[model samples]
Target: MLNETKDPLPVAERVVGVRLESPLVGAADLIKAQEGRASKAFAMRELPFRDLVNVRGELSDPAFVAAFAGVVGCEPPAAPNTVARSDHYDVLWLGPDEWLVRSLAPVQTGMLEAKLTAVLGDAYAAAVDIGSGNTVVEIEGTRARDVLSRGCPLDLHPRLFKPGQCAQSVYFKASIVLIPTGDDHFEIVVRRSFADYFCRIMVDAAASVAP
Candidate 1:
């Protein structure tokens, strides 16, 4: 009899049986506690499972710019501390040649990275799916900026840090990518490891300043 062999299942198939949880899965009660004060001053909540892709390329190259814009619906913001927004994505400037592309809506893991890679074919660029590496926390209300100002050193005055702008900064001990989505609203992109600490600390800060 001929020897028989079988091909192993793909990594994706093998992992299909796994269950995923948000980094802030353990902070449900903490978040609920803050919800009571949400209507008054500020509220904090985790926006989990967002599709985050880190893209890097030289914008000076015509091919790179074209390829990126083709896929992202806009050229990467060349200006420091700015964000390029599309109907489906918000491209936040992380460096002169690096950006974080965040989907406006959640998507199947790897779906965004695959689309970006396909469109940027052979270009001197990279698209990495870092969705599982971090989580987004939204803090909004009348006192949202006040709560952030407690730990963040940036001057959040409207004339200084308005909507459509982003900065890499720290919230107390956690390194965060801060985005101003509106006058009194902000989104913080923090590493998964720090999600718990960041949320707990933020809630405490908000309570101290609660009206």
Candidate 2:
């Protein structure tokens, strides 16, 4: 509907050409600038506007697992902390019975929710779209692990953490679902409310070692 050409918002809320946003909208630029002041050890940037859905289902129920697998086109991860990827989405395991599904393509709001609901029905499974409630940050550089390990307690060495791994853990003061996407890269999910604080933390760290 954005191409409808009519004002997207009511006339009272309209600004000639301004885009409505949150305080963190421009924080990425500031973080990038701050990273420039560092020693170029690693780099961090925000991955904005990803579709996220929080799912809780009965892992013991075959119907529950099959329902999501049909919609996601991949079986939900049953591991303690793992990730499964399909052509269109990444299903991250947060716990034995909880997972977070993220879409690779930009989708219309409510599309993911409706799609899952249709397949899930009124079963014991539950799915809640949380795309707007969380923000994803990517940290990767020559010494990405070194930089992240400063705040996170996880053992990021290749011997332990590797691709397709995901865990719910603390990063400094904020809680995050840390996903290892590559040997030198990670996707950290922080709550929107903590995004600003999280950005500041990474910026400060990246300043000492940005590349």
Candidate 3:
């Protein structure tokens, strides 16, 4: 007689009607295991599975700005290349009519889209989820600037790139969005396709100094 066997994997769990299982990692993880960390100089890690959305709307429109501030839980930046920061989210100004909204908490993409759409009725705007298409890498430590300057030409001096500043710059060959969150601390947003290449570049740059 044959006996039935049970599955080894744990059943998927859910919270608030959302699936909370099927764990995943970011593109950088593929090389994270093999790379020699520059911890002595700079520490690096991928901030995967974040709530990142592309926002395009007219800031001149009061209704549009109001709708955006409502959902993001913070007001949008009026100046160019600046970030409106809060404990839960950050609104990054990319252009006169474009912005990138990154939420600290993981959220439902569809639900967030729906909420924004509903609030922006008759307003010319769009909220597109790019979480699956890109990821963020945080690098910070004593020698962070040296590692970044290896490929990036931006003047990342503390006097020039203090907290609350963001810019579009190139790293190696990848065009990335750079945000300085604190002294020697930065967040880089890169396309999923270029993530692997950039990770390798980061490892090489970090190797120059020491761990």
Candidate 4:
């Protein structure tokens, strides 16, 4: 049986799409677990073997792409960086001129964005801090894509959604960036304010996908 009520309680803390049948803590309970939450920010359980690096810069510069591509020894395709990696770099394009370079070790975000900006030189790029304004939720387990497909339009097929690939699109009416980490795992980047509402929609969507 499912709740199916207009306002079902949220499970999975900062994450929204938790299965109704699975044990979960309430949103308020999850909030209480974290210490430094005043507003516009919250944290969830750290995802295994993954770290988030947010970078902001003028994505308009042609040289910017070239330098990034140089690191990989091939031209970066006309998409974001989640689909390509060199030893440890997984670039996920966040916007036209912005990208999120992910790796196992945390790097200085400002320094990296600065390096790109300096390389562009007079190309006039600036990197901004978006860590507090967004939430990056990693969706794993074997059935993850099946859960995401209910609300996301982008193809989740492994052939189409290879690792090191990322896309920004609307999920349940809220805009988000989807980064594929594995055949079954995905990283969801969403704004802070809509986290709760988005989680609710995700739970409903996931429940519908449950067998």
Candidate 5:
């Protein structure tokens, strides 16, 4: 049917915005939100069966470096982004004198820690399990960098933070180790005692961003 045609003014589409489920949402929902929306979310989850091994030997010792390389199966003088990984373990260079060895499985962590401590005898180094003292917070989504920048002083631009990067820094007025899990995700390692406080600060900060 032919009607008087008047060009209708363009109407802006009223797109529906997603409502955040809740901070108490399930893991499945959390994963879904991260995949769908470009929202940053942090979950303070209990990470079981992990270990932190620190090498205490002098950095200048050639024999020590060779022995470490033998066990780690990688060069001691590591270049940037140099990470040695076994099936269940990963060795990350923290500095010229320090490095962090971590593992997911308890047996794997125990075996590796014992092996390294034994291999690198009293004269070589020490390996202590400090896993009990820390808490792990998994953060994900596109806004992850901005959420972290509120508390951290480091430049988190992707160009500076490549994958597998970890650094010790001030997080919400507490010291923590920030590990990049992906391009838009990170795992924040904080002390166990300060976990509750850390979570509270993160919750408040996230609310502002999410709103």
Candidate 6:
């Protein structure tokens, strides 16, 4: 007689109907408090719930590159401090062998990471969903650069740091991935742990530069 056996893998849990909060839950209130103190030429807001995946692999490996391209719809940026973008995602070069994949829109958590991991199977690579660990903050308008320059040490001159470029730098005490989205617009990807402090410091900086 043969005995019945249960499946070894456990079933994935489905969570639903839960309310979600962004890392900077109080950002709106903080911005409102600044009111006229903050510059009219500057604005700051959190782009919460974005999907972020940290991918690591050798770009020289054709198989690894192909696998990533097949899943992400574009080859990872080969140039240092550049970004490779597609309709759905933007791949930012973090290091010689590391890239941060950010979704243009909100996606089911871990969906992209799972697809990447599945396709990159047995290839020297790794895909980790870091969405929950980070949040995006957008600072724009005429005085945006001034606010950033107050604490960030990078050269904010347009001739030097143009669009489609990114760099890992520190904003005051918080480490951030800075991306120039337009002439006067920049996005900062910072850790959830530092979101509050980042907003407070940024607000203070904006107020300092107010006209």
Writing each residue's lDDT as its tens digit, candidate 5 over 1-211 gives 1122443533222112313222223343444444454343443344544666666565677777667667766544354334566665666666766676666454423455666777776456666665556545677767677778888899999988856667878876878877786887787667767765676676556656653
lDDT of 6 by residue, 1-211 (tens): 1112443433342234335578888676895675534455888877888889999999889999999999899999989999999889999999999999999887766689999999998889999999988999888889999999999999999999989999999999999999999999998999999989999999888878845
Per TM-score, the best of the predicted structures is 1
List, residue by residue over 11-123, the lDDT tens digit for candidate 1. 66656665668888888888877776576478787888889999999988899899888888889999999999998889999999999999887766667898889988788
- Which residue ranges in model 3 land beyond 4 Å of their true spot? 1-31, 34-38
Candidate 1: stretches off by over 4 Å: 1-8, 15-17
- Number of clashes in model 1? 0
Task: Give one digit per residue, the lDDT tens place, for model 3 in 1-211.
Answer: 1112443433332223443321124433644653344455688877766778888898789999899888888877878889997677898889989888887766654455667778989899988877767778888888888889999999989998878879999999988999998888899888877887888888788778546
Checking candidate 3 for backbone clashes, the offending pairs are: none
TM-score of each: 0.91, 0.84, 0.82, 0.58, 0.68, 0.89
RMSD of candidate 3 to true structure, Å: 6.6
TM for candidate 6 is 0.89
Task: Give lDDT per model, in order.
Answer: 0.88, 0.78, 0.77, 0.55, 0.62, 0.87
Give the C-alpha miss distance for residue 43 in model 1, angstroms.
Answer: 0.9
Output the worst ten-in-a-row residue range by lDDT, candidate 6: 1-10
Candidate 5 stretches with Cα past 4 Å from truth are 1-46, 58-62, 69-83, 105-111
Q: What is the lDDT of residue 33 in candidate 2?
A: 76
In order of listing, the candidates' clash counts read 0, 6, 0, 8, 0, 0
Off by over 4 Å in 4: 1-82, 86-89, 94-96, 103-121
